[model samples]
Target: MIRKINRIFQDYMREKRLKIGKNIWDRKNKEKIIEDNNFIEDNNIKSILFLRYDGKIGDMVINTIMFREIKKSYPEIKIGVVTRGGAKDIISNNKNVDKIYEYNKKTSEVKKLAREIALEKYDLLIDFSEMLRVNQMMFINMCKAKINIGINKKDWNLFEVSLKSIDYHYHISNLYLEILKFLGIKNIVRKYDLFPTNYMIEKLNLKNKKYVVFNPYAASKHRSFNLENMIKISEIILEKNFDKLILIGTKNHLSELERIKKRFGDKIIIPETENILEVVELISKANLVVTPDTSIVHIAATFERKMLCIYRREIGKEDKNSILWGPNYDQARVIYVDEKVKNGEEIDINKIKIEKLKEKIDEI
Candidate 1:
């Protein structure tokens, strides 16, 4: 009941704010002239700032991939990124990013951070955050960048250069690359390039096992897999001749890990730690990784580890090139669980086909 009410309230606020934002944008568009590609090239940008406010795992992955291509075009350019604290670990080691700025979404730190950004004197600012949040709009307007590029949303007139997608059906990596294309960056390369440290790899002692890692938790309940399904999947992995199974997440997932362990004691390894780099190192050594659509999956992609990614139907819209986003450098496969109903009721675990899952496991 509480979840239903929260969803209703959230939808109401979204619609209300979107209406107001559209009206503001319409008024602004009538007065300002939209610039063209010629104007962008004339600006001569030397430094670029990328912003990812939504801070989802996919968005960070797209950002990291796009930044690599952007760096290749302008090797001498300085690139910076601003994201939430949760994504700090993913973006911290990104080669294209010279500096990383983190901000709390709930506090005034966003505004304070924006102020500092306004003083950076950047040549271009790219807002990869698709949402039209008021604070982000304010920050984009304040930045000293000569060329500002972003999505052509209802409030797109506020940006000097913009690219519009047909709908939300487009892949996020392509969407980000579209903005780069608008800025005259044409040599596009789509691949995940995250380099893990030797220190991180050494700490996990990952060389000894033919193992697969599983991360069944997500920040939002709506995106998480049912614990029962997670347990069944773990059991299938153990039965399929795998040596070990590592479960990684925060302490909140300990109960679920314990539940899995109870069924297959000592075979399931759940390491408790607040350090994300350690988790990355552990994931790097895995022979295969089974995870929900989360940041850990992005880390696994960096190491080119074979992956069995289970994505919810609703969130699957964001995964445009499903196979491309998988372990691109090595063996990987993506299994999308479409909406399935049983006995006139929406069943969560039933959405994933166990037989198809086993077939994919056998292929890997």
Candidate 2:
């Protein structure tokens, strides 16, 4: 299949890039390297840059905790982040982030950013990219920081102080916490930081109305709900005696959402949102959130809102996503549509039946 071929090709390229990095960095930097995080304080590090070029909103949400905890521990340190794919909006108004660099994946743009960061002469650079991407590795090599720290999933010469391999038994957010623990941060609290505006509240006139947020779209088809299935689930929730059903999606989903809106009439309110922050404001005030596997799961978790999530897994394979990135709050409920999936195959969330959803809604 094309997906399998792409994976093989990507692995081959990653290995090739790693080899080139070893050759380039091994010869370029011959100075003594420290293996611990003491270099942060010993060198009197003032400015710290974090590389989060993966750019998924959920990953950015998870890293928000690191920005807050790091600032709490080192109040005088200046924090900077390099993010791509418009994920900069997640941390746009964050008080802990002093600077944010946007990478557009263009060679000229990246080189320009490198020059700009080099001029700042940052003291520390931290990379939480769990895997080696050629672009991220190249960017890390270009930044002129006094010290570099990165996750050591595989052997690489780029980092002076490499953190240990990620432990899959725990939540993925803990990896960011591990980075903080390495820097001697204590009493760390595992949570997400997202601030929303009052514009959405005022415009929707939802001062104190009870509502449930239904997000049926994700970045991938395998995780998104089809129109028919979404309708069935929506009807079930509407029968639960709630004030309203607020449907959410991107512009690409507008046509489908409009069809559902027409079917439900005034019962469904699909508010036009300017950005992801408006969506955050909407979710923060929701009585409950129902979503497929997506970043919304983490957003609802950030507010510790009552949520029900639909997830999928291979029949016989280990469910890595549920273990690592599942709901972080204790009050959340998740339903997996694995019974219909073939062994070792990706789960199609649309296959989840209406009866199963109704059961969960009633229980909640």
Check candidate 1 and list the clashing pairs. Answer: none
* lDDT, candidate 2, at 51: 86
TM-score for each of the candidates: 0.81, 0.92
lDDT, candidate 2, 1-364, per-residue tens: 9988998899899799877765764322623644455555766779899988778888888889988998988889999999976478878888989999998687678778988898998888888867765556667778868778877733566666778867777789888877877776789999899877768877887767888999999878888999999899889888887888999998878889999989988879898887888999999999889998888999999999989998887777788888788887886899988854554456788888778788888888
lDDT of 1 at 119: 85
Clashing residue pairs found in predicted model 2: none
Which segments of candidate 1 are over 4 A away from where they belong? 1-41, 166-170, 314-330, 340-347
- Candidate 1 displacement at residue 211 in angstroms: 1.0
Q: Every model's Cα RMSD, please?
A: 4.4, 2.4
**Model 1: lDDT of residue 117:** 82
Error of 2 at 66 (Å): 0.8
lDDT of 1 by residue, 176-223 (tens): 666667666776777666655556434445466688888877666655
User: What lDDT does the true structure give each of the candidates?
Assistant: 0.69, 0.82
Instruction: Provide the clash count, candidate 2.
Output: 0
